[model samples]
Target: MKTRKAKEQIVKELKEKFEKASLVILTNFDGMTVAESNKLRRSLKEVGAEYKVVKNTLMRYAYPGTPVEQIKDAFTGPTGIVFAFDDIVAAAKALKEFFEEKDSKLKFKAAVVEGKVADVEMIKQLASLPGREELLGQLAFTLKYPVNAVAWSLDNLFQKLVTVLENVKAEKESA
Candidate 1:
């Protein structure tokens, strides 16, 4: 157990991170083993997220004035928090994948994503979204497709105009 001063320090840091995080996922890890928890932490870390098993009391202390307040009720029963400072979708996908792979007592409680309160269902939906890089790549392809089509059409039009001009020049030269 942490001392009173340590707990206060944790709460203060958590509050500051809660303010900065793009998304905070609250989960119930009621029956998760240490190994399983470490695996989950690794998975989350790969996606630019930090996973912490915080005391509910400490979390409560950290929650009141931040976006985490929206999901304060979830801070009960073996609670773990996943903080996504970068890509929320990648973080969500990592959590969801780990949860499904474990098939244990792990369960999502709630989340605050981009200042919006989300339930487990919404979190699952978020997990299904493409990652930031994938979405950006798709957008780039979409934008490039139209530009390439326009360039090709313009090239064809120019070639046809040149051919017509060449034919007219030939006719005038013959006359």
Candidate 2:
């Protein structure tokens, strides 16, 4: 039983979090135990995501002017919001893995990712996709590949030139 001031503060915090979040996933935490909830929160936190169980009324008030506002109906049920401020895929992947690892009754209602609404299937696809660090590593490798190839080609050409010069010098010495 929170006071009016405390509820207002909660709304303020929700608004700020919603504003900053890149992906806001609405979860139905119907039968989650306290231990399971704590585990979920910790796992989400590990991947730069936050799980908040705010009241639907508070969320509705905070939803205005945010991307998640369009899916207002999702606020219904035992709603919990998973805010992925950094990388959407990583957060989705983390949640999906948790679902697989446990007999999780926490159902994902939907996600507003980058202002686009993603359905349950879409979220699953997102979870299957590579995470932020993995994607970045791939991008770095892709960017470095051509540069490395060119450097290797140049080194090979220089080595050939050096060999030719050495052969010529040896011939001159013999002459």
Candidate 3:
């Protein structure tokens, strides 16, 4: 029962969300209660994701010209949208955990990640991946490990040369 002005405002907000999100997930909240949805929202918020149960029409309006527009056809049924601006894996993990914990009625409808339409299985796979910080830490280790090893190797070679020089000096002094 929203007026035209209110609906327009909502569409505008959705547009902004779509612009910012790197991961856009659509879900069907067919049997979920208000309390359950709010709990899910809180869980998503902890990981910096926004969740909204949107009217398909408004979502469709917001979708066109946006990266998530590729999945506009998925806006059927009780569509719930999750917008993850950063750390898509963390958001996916939060959602998957909530789904597992409550055995909730949330069903994955579709996903558009990084401007590409992705399969529902992608969400599952993303959930299994480590968070952004962990991935960055792992990448840093991978990038720097060889450099550290080379530095250590050089230091070890120098130590051996120094030891050999010392041994030669000792031999010469004795002779």
Error of 1 at 100 (Å): 1.8
RMSD of 1: 2.1
Q: Kindly list the per-residue Cα lDDT of model 3 for residues 83-166, writing each as its tens digit.
A: 999889999999888767746898888888888888877888989998999989999999999999999999999999999999
Give the TM-score of each candidate: 0.87, 0.90, 0.85
Could you tell me which residue pairs clash in candidate 2? none
Candidate 3 local distance difference test against the native = 0.90
Top TM-score hit = 2
How well does candidate 1 score on lDDT at residue 117? 94
Model 3 clash pairs are none
Candidate 1: pairs in clash: none
Report the lDDT tens digits of candidate 1 across residue range 90-126.
Answer: 9999988887783666788888999989888888899
Kindly provide the TM-score of model 3 when superposed on the true structure, using C-alpha atoms: 0.85
